[model samples]
Target: MPIVLYHFPLSPPCRTALCTAKALGLDVTIKIVNLLAKEHLNEDYVKMNPEHTIPSLDDNGLIIWHSHAIATYLVSKYGKDDSLYPVDPAKRVVVDQRLYFDATTLFPRLRATTFPLMFLGKTDVEPDKKAAIYEALGILEKYLEPTGWVAGDHVTVADIACAVTTATLQAMGVVLDAYPKIREWLERCNSTIPHFEEANKEALKDVAELIKSKVTHNVYAP
Candidate 1:
């Protein structure tokens, strides 16, 4: 059986897997799960990934769930560029650490702040989530300036994982104005990487539209 990637465009973890797959130039099939339809909650999907998550990877019938696990598995199995998932022990550890932070720390806070607004279509209480979101962005900004990427001097699974969350935050009206370094880093990541733009496309339109609407309202406010 060929490798199949179960995913959703809006899901950060799913996008992480997608980005990694693309970066490796792997010709894996993508099965786009519909988050809006709650298709992922179906029993079949649940069986594949008991968690019923967006990014359950089927690798020649060996199923793997979780973005971090999928990423490592892909690199270990198929990555041509050692740069994608470096061989150095220390650099590998850094990638692992960043992935851990992305899965636990960065994603949770970002989702808490933005998911309620974007997925649920609720504009209320945005101000309540703003502080936490800003803090998260500030942390990313600080981290980007001192390092070449989240894991080291090269793009790794860490950058791919975090990029999903970063893209989502940008989509949900999280301002980047305060995080100049992060903005610059994002540019570098998208420009330098072949598949970063593909991974980012879904969120880009929504993000730009959201920002434009907000800015227009503010500009015309009495």
Candidate 2:
């Protein structure tokens, strides 16, 4: 059987795994999982991923969850070269830092804002949550100043992971007024990354519509 990806289209993290597979040029069968419906909580799914996260990858018999881990596995096992994940220790750690920042800082902020809006019908993000997201983006801007991409000069899983989050934030009405570098990098990502549009085509639209229904204004400036 081909590699099976348990995915939810609206998830930013799932987009990372899908983008990595596209970049690696691997054929993966995507089986949609509804997080809103508690599909990930199913016994079969929890057995494969105790965390029950969206975007679990079953590569043959090796079941992997968490977008960052799944992405690293696919890249390490199948990448023709180490470009997406450099082999050098120093370079790898830089990429690792950006990946971790995305997981801990960038995406978490997005989740913080969106969860309440999507589930609890909150119209405005709490002030501290807005501040946290912009703080993460400010650091990201400086990271990109040294190199066009987040990890380094070239796109890596770090950029792929963070791009989805930032792009979703944009769709959710977070203006990029202060983060010109991030704006440019995101533009470059859309053009340079393979299957980038296909990777996020519907998710962005869905996010826009969903967010539009919840909030009347765009936010997070400077």
For residues 107-202, write the lDDT of model 1, one tens digit per residue: 887667445545665554445456766676677776687775777777788888887788767765566777777777788778877788876785
lDDT of 2 by residue, 101-180 (tens): 99999999899988998888788888899888888889989999987998877999999999989998888878888889
Off by over 4 Å in 2: 219-222
lDDT for residue 32 in candidate 1, whole number 0-100: 86
Task: List TM-scores for all candidates, in order.
Answer: 0.87, 0.96
Model 2: per-residue Cα lDDT at residue 23: 87
* Residue 57 in candidate 2, Cα distance off native in Å: 0.4
How far does residue 54 in candidate 2 sit from its true spot (Å)? 1.3
Q: Which candidate achieves the best lDDT against the true structure?
A: 2
Candidate 2 positional error at 92, Å: 0.4
